[model samples]
Target chain A: MINPINIGSIDDIDEGEAKVIPSDETGTGEDIAVFHAEDGNFYALNDNCTHETASLADGWIEGTEVECPIHAAKFCLKKGTALCMPATQDARTHKVEVSGNDLLLYPNVPAEPVEA
Target chain B: MSDCTSHTSEANASIGRMSRPEAFTQNIDVSTLVDSDGGLIDRSIYTETSIYAQEQRRIFARSWLFLAHTSQFKKPGDFFTTFMGEDPIIVTMDKTKTIRAYLNSCRHRGVRLCRADAGATKMFTCTYHGWSFDLAGALQSVPNEKAYPEDFDRKQWGLIEVPNVQSYKGLIFGNWDKDAQSLEENLGDMRYYMDAMLDRDPEGTEVMGGVMKWTLEGNWKLAAEQFATDWYHVNMSHASALMVLSPTGRGPKAEIAATPGRQFGSENGHGAGFPTHPKSRFDARPVHEYYDYEALRERLGDAAVEGPMTTGHATVFPNFSYLPVNGSIRVWHPKGPDKMEVWAWVLVDKSMPDEVKDAQRLYNLRTFGPSGIFEADDGENWSEIQAISHGFVTNNVPLNFQMGIGSERNDGTYPGQTSELYSDAAGRAFYRHWSKQMNTPAWHERTEQA
Candidate 1:
């Protein structure tokens, strides 16, 4: 069953940044990174760095790239292409929906999903 | 110079035949190598100085050593620095999407060209003299162009190109010997096994993240041999994990106490030693239960999965080897005769679920990382073996490798390779090949012999 839960309010943040939403009663797993893109759209990717397994929440968010703190491998938060070396694989991306003031995330996507 | 030439010619006369006294002394008893009872050599070959040097020239230089996976350099200007043996190299993808590797040292002042872990840049400017090189390894500019003569050709001053660089199934390998066999020819039968691991998914496999690099105090061959066939050590080395995972009194101790051990050796010096019913009789309760054994069996096929899942290793000759059930690829990059940097990568099937990959990565870290339980035990033993072998007395003494000697029979499966899946002498064959390369004349002569 897919349980939709309220994570955070949209008015709390500015543009081109993210918020870590903790897995609550209706969430799937641990904290998920919810990003507010420059285009005014919110997206969520796995908060873990695909390189050294560091936390992406602590990484520097520049434009569309999140540079891992440990190895500095950049990841395109929207498409999840590990932009540099060290990280040869993409991070798992989650579906994010802004329902009124509540930020809803679906962590059902696999870490490395295979496309049919 | 005259004396050196004479020595060279004399060495050339004995090409393709073992003549070096050190080769015989360092390897198994010379009589046993040719005779039927050759598989008895233990971990001694892995530590021998003469053998290691020979491998550097024959196997490592000639054979294709894995550099980096292609996924690391997907962008035009992206680059990563790695080593081809002890030589520093920079791998880059150009605007044309073609991958190229060049010596990392600057041609002008011999400074390391690339220092960053990885990045995209139109040109790499040497921090020392301000010389710059494009992605294609061409020297683009010099700080003081007037300092050189008008006849100076910037084209001639490009970064030294490695002799051969190629990729097969996303895995890239670089070779130093220009006239050596192609990467395809060198891989040979090992390609089949690699295919089974890599080519399963249509999109092919990608390096999960960055490579895990660590140094272990042992000869490179020790790392290779352990991944090749040291399953016997696991029962004792990893006894704590086994005991914890095993149900009550059901473990390797009980199983070995009950029945004679079962071991299977493969052709071309690849083999494993463990009980026949590894899954049923062994203590794999923790890992086996958690992992999707059914999916593994279905994906790897019945024969690949039927082996001792708990304990087994396959050495693919020269440098690379892995234990599939263990979920790791071990590469022993040679630093020197006594030291090697062990590069281990956790391999997961592209088709596996995300949670499974995460679980496998965690399991791999706990089992094989620098601080891993199993690696800690193995590292101590490897270091001790190297220290002991350095002794004048211990070095001369012939290490016993006489297990399952004459019992091995030719299965007629692999050509130019022998199979003895149940013997300890499989390691002896590895050394035999080692001695053959070490004792043979230089590459020119060996090529002529081939």
Candidate 2:
């Protein structure tokens, strides 16, 4: 089982901006990007864009969505839905939770499903 | 009535131009074309122009045609443009909160008045000569009115109103024949089955969005009959779709001949087939999961819940058909002998949550929309039938509908004739009703099974 890693205080990442956790600490080989979205909530997805070799962490965050840096493709940060073009597949998502003042990331664990 | 625009009377003008012609239908006999009891049907019923022309007058003109739903008109001035057979119609709610329909032509030059499919309008103005009509089809104004003779009465120039207009459970229907039966009388025992989709909740039902229309090269009856009857086709026709949906080969296995459900033929030619399917097979999750069984039971008795309620296709006589499970209602309009225009709408309980309504809409689109998988299969079959029947030799051949022919029965449990799910009794019954309407010239002379 993968343990929950403390990603420090919620104040560490600004709203509408994202930060990346290196693959070595994640132990899953893939880098994880943590987003503090415009909805004032924390979300995590695999750092690499599904369309090409680009970091989603560096893309622009627009209202709970992140535009990929290289191709301009967009994805829904909450459910990792591929919102628009050059990308047809969704990026892998990891569960994230805010407990008190700290942000905890459960590596390799899937988040609650998109509301039906 | 004198036509104001035309000076010469058409009857007096045609006196020397032409002689009276024999009836066009003198050659084609409807009796030999369809032997519903015998299970034999002629191919020309699906491909002949003469027979189709007869249908426009005999079937479309006289029957209670489903035009629109009540939810479409939230307030006054809300109007929807549709067709009864080939003629265009406008259905609108006036300021009185009363619904009315009119023949969608300007009284001035016979030009189509309502160009848009649906919109809010207090009045319809003709783009040709600027003739204006109110929501209730009254002629409010006519351009150059004083230029004509003093006998040019504006009151006589109103939009032609439909003879009969009525609504049953928020589903509106219009009839051109004034002396024909009432909407409730025409619906007959079919109303029992219709309640399966419409009356499940006291909260009422509403059509989701504007209709999705598309043309297909097929006879309208082919589509209608498929809905009314033909459960036998699904196990073969939609096998590929079922197979794809069931990657593990554990898909819906509601076998036809052995299933406990029933196929029914109503008193007024409506047909229904409800084949049992396991809940594990597949269903519109938002609709099924959220249904209040106790509420439904309270609103509807055991006869409705346990009776021959439709879980599949159903038709109301001529061409109104709906899928109770898929939540789609459609009308197959006869475009020509070899063509049809399909108008479809998605419906759901008005009380459902927005998310559930959205899910129901998506489910209906994936299952019965113009490009839906099952719809594609049904379309291919209908179009191919029309294509192959064009041959003289092929057209002469009679198709067999002999599956359980003599087995149709009524146990007094349900309202109409019924047989096992796999039987073609309902199809035969539908054709039989079509033949009766075609052969009889007068509505009063026609025989209706009680």
Candidate 3:
């Protein structure tokens, strides 16, 4: 269980854009990137790129994927899946919910649970 | 005096050369280490921190350094990033179409201003603090104008500008010292050789898309000297690569012992070595020879193309080096005493057909790119030399440079002190001019034989 932290309104991030949620607020000891995907839905992933030392929040947000700016390794924003070469591991995804106009971020909570 | 000096040096604006490399190091302490007079080079010059720091101050900072080709700056607000001795710089063409180079650091907090390798933008807004600078590097906007003190003047704080910038033909160069001599004066006889590569098509040249960059653990001079003067190593060091390049025949060691070749060193430490035979081609690859010699005969005389000494390797003083065979232009940006970062660009004639241009790109990469065959051979030698310099015993050994020492002559065949086919005359000249520049603190007090 995790406490929901209010991360401004949905209007704070525009379509095809992303905003960085600071590390201290994430409770996971890593920075979180709340991306407003082009699909008109918001998704959250760990900000640090798994390939090299670069912030994923500063990367390009495509339809449902984000490309790492450092080496252009694309990752699936929906499942935080690394979708290209040079990046083998998946990015950690965080749970975020849009309630009316307010965007709520759940710290330390996984967005999806995989099969054991 | 030989006829080469008598005839050429009568009008020779360039001083010390292959024959007499110690032209400017008459009174310097570094001369003892690089005893060009006796043909012995001290090993410490490659690994000493004090000598390396002095090189940064006197050599890289004062010499005319290569910037960027003119093709990258066709538009008004176009810009690109390059380094001047490890100091990042932005070369741009402002609204007036005037070319300029400025330090890449933001004036406000000294953070890097432009992070992109290259792109055109009207304004560069600092990612930190959002301080904006216009195309000419003028401070344009401050995010919070009201928060600043009343006396804070925006005009006073602009991106620091490189003191001098100029171009030779299409090649642009920058200098940190304003008092340094003109690029032409520094280039001297080396320009005559450069014309062979740059003036071939009359359509001029353009760098093929993309730059190839990589790092190696080696002192910068180790590579620069080889490019400028050490073609003698090509047969030995790159023997395996040559075998792969030309399987059966002797390759471009083509009658090397039997052929007539000349090694030349100019006033400002520039050096080149090439065989004088008209048909002596380094790479047997025919696609690289697409230049129309008859069409160029109108601009350049028959002698220029016929005797293609300019077809070989050459280096301009400190670090700018180029090879005509694969059309690779590169600058060895010195990282420290034992490391260098190589930034290379593949240049081609603008009028070349698409396929030929593509072939040039491939050949350029296959031969000299990061993983290139010849590049690998060269890197290993430089790296091994650097690694061995770490030993206290090996560090004190004086390397032999006595190949064709007394053979430097001027028969009026090529240019200044065209020594024997295989010689360290150019290397001696290189270290001589290096010691001279390292010793002279003031630009004006520096003397030339002329």
Candidate 4:
């Protein structure tokens, strides 16, 4: 089970834009990037680009896809699917919903560390 | 009595600092530097000044070093100035096109004879005095000859020549050791990879207009090892460079996924890496479209041009390194334990069109040149790591190279010891060879042990 945490109001982000919110969820201290898609929906994903330690929110957004600013690896903003050579692993996605003009995030719990 | 004091004093003082061997207080202990399986090495190897001095003697002095490309010295009187470790050298070709190298120092007063980076000239006249030497490094003229004995032999005063100078394909290398192995023998399995670039076109390769030089606060081995064996970093470090260089950030996902590649390590510390599949070349961007792939394929076939041969890079031990994709050749000149002077050049096929050559040169500059985006990204990590080493906490920090410790094995698919690209087996092999060289006092004893 997971709890939804209030991120911010819808007025904070522009339509079809993304912003990163720092969190200590899963104790990783990694940031969670939230997107306000042009599709009239909000989405959330891990801020760190799976390919490297770059903020995906700082990347260029075209429709529902975001391009990493550091290396331009495109990720599907809807599903967090890595769409290029350098990034093979899919970025971890999160669940988001809106309540009373406020955005709520339920970040996917990180997988347990596998022991060798 | 002559009124002039010793003319050699100032020049001798300069040469003395350059030539004097660093005194060692005690034998360096490399035992902790390298781990048992050769999978881990101490970060101190990159930061310790004493260890760098040992490497200068044990590793650099005994190795054949890349000096210049043969195309640079096309005719008689064509000459270039470079370095063998820290010692300056002048490479020239005589009337017969015979390549020769001499210590850049003048015999009379030890002044550097050739100051220009490169040019063509019949003789190099030292600026400190009017001393001059012929193209073949023969003493030609001296100023005020009455200062010495009548029996003073000018023949014995020619520029000090390096004992060994050789070339493979168009690459010229020099060595101070008379007993050092031939460049080809030293290159060994690495030659197969080098030929992918050298033998790509029937016309051979030539260095582009000028060399790019820059300084970075980092150890030379860090750059050399990364070029040789660190493909794992590409997924993370150069992620942005790949997206920018490719066609609108659309790369051949099929090729990248199909052939992840393998890394190769040899006994002599040479390292190479390339994809296992021949049809899986990594240059899928539109920027690379101008490359005459059809001609390259026809000349070298798919196996040599389509696989790691076309996409990979290698180092000829110590410091010389080059890439096949961009044709960038460089030597990581050690300035100190924590500093390196990078002298880089772009090599292109002689048959390439002017426009294509220009495009290639620009692409090389954008990708690997000093101000290149990718180069800046790499420098950030290297310089940061070097700075971090100054902290006392770094003494306890054991850097890990154990990416694929026990997985290294020989396979028919590639030459020498092969491992998956995800592994640091090549880095481990490098330290294994480095430890052996640093522990041995001389090249002869190292060979004798073998």
Which candidate model has the greater lDDT, 1 or 4?
A: 4
Per-model i-RMS: 12.9, 26.0, 10.0, 25.4
Name the runs in model 2 displaced over 4 angstroms: A1-116, B1-28, B247-250, B254-258, B277-281, B306-310, B443-450
Write candidate 3's Cα lDDT for B126-209 as tens digits.
Answer: 777767677777776665567889999987777777767878767889887666687877888787677777766657888889
lDDT of 4 by residue, A86-109 (tens): 678888878787898998887675
Off by over 4 Å in 1: A1-116, B1-55, B253-300, B308-311, B407-422, B441-450
Instruction: Indicate the TM-score of model 2.
Output: 0.73
Q: For each candidate, C-alpha RMSD in Å?
A: 16.0, 20.0, 13.1, 28.2
TM for candidate 3 is 0.72
Indicate the worst ten consecutive residues by lDDT in candidate 2 chain B.
B1-10
Candidate 2: give the TM-score of chain A: 0.95
Looking at model 3, residue B171 earns an lDDT score of: 85
Give lDDT tens digits, candidate 3, residues A21-115: 99887778899999999989888999988865667887778898998754566899878889996688999888889999999998767786533
DockQ of each: 0.02, 0.01, 0.02, 0.00
* TM-scores, one per candidate: 0.65, 0.73, 0.72, 0.71
Query: What digit string (tens of lDDT, one per residue) describes model 4 on residues B330-426?
Result: 9999888999999999898787777877777887888787888678888878888887887878855878888888877877756678888777888
lDDT of 2 by residue, B264-315 (tens): 8865778988754333234576777787766776777655565433357788
Q: Looking at model 4, give its docking quality level.
A: incorrect
**Model 3 CA deviation exceeding 4 Å by range:** A1-116, B1-29, B247-254, B284-289, B295-298, B309-311, B442-450
Q: For residue B389, give model 2's deviation from the true position in Å.
A: 1.1
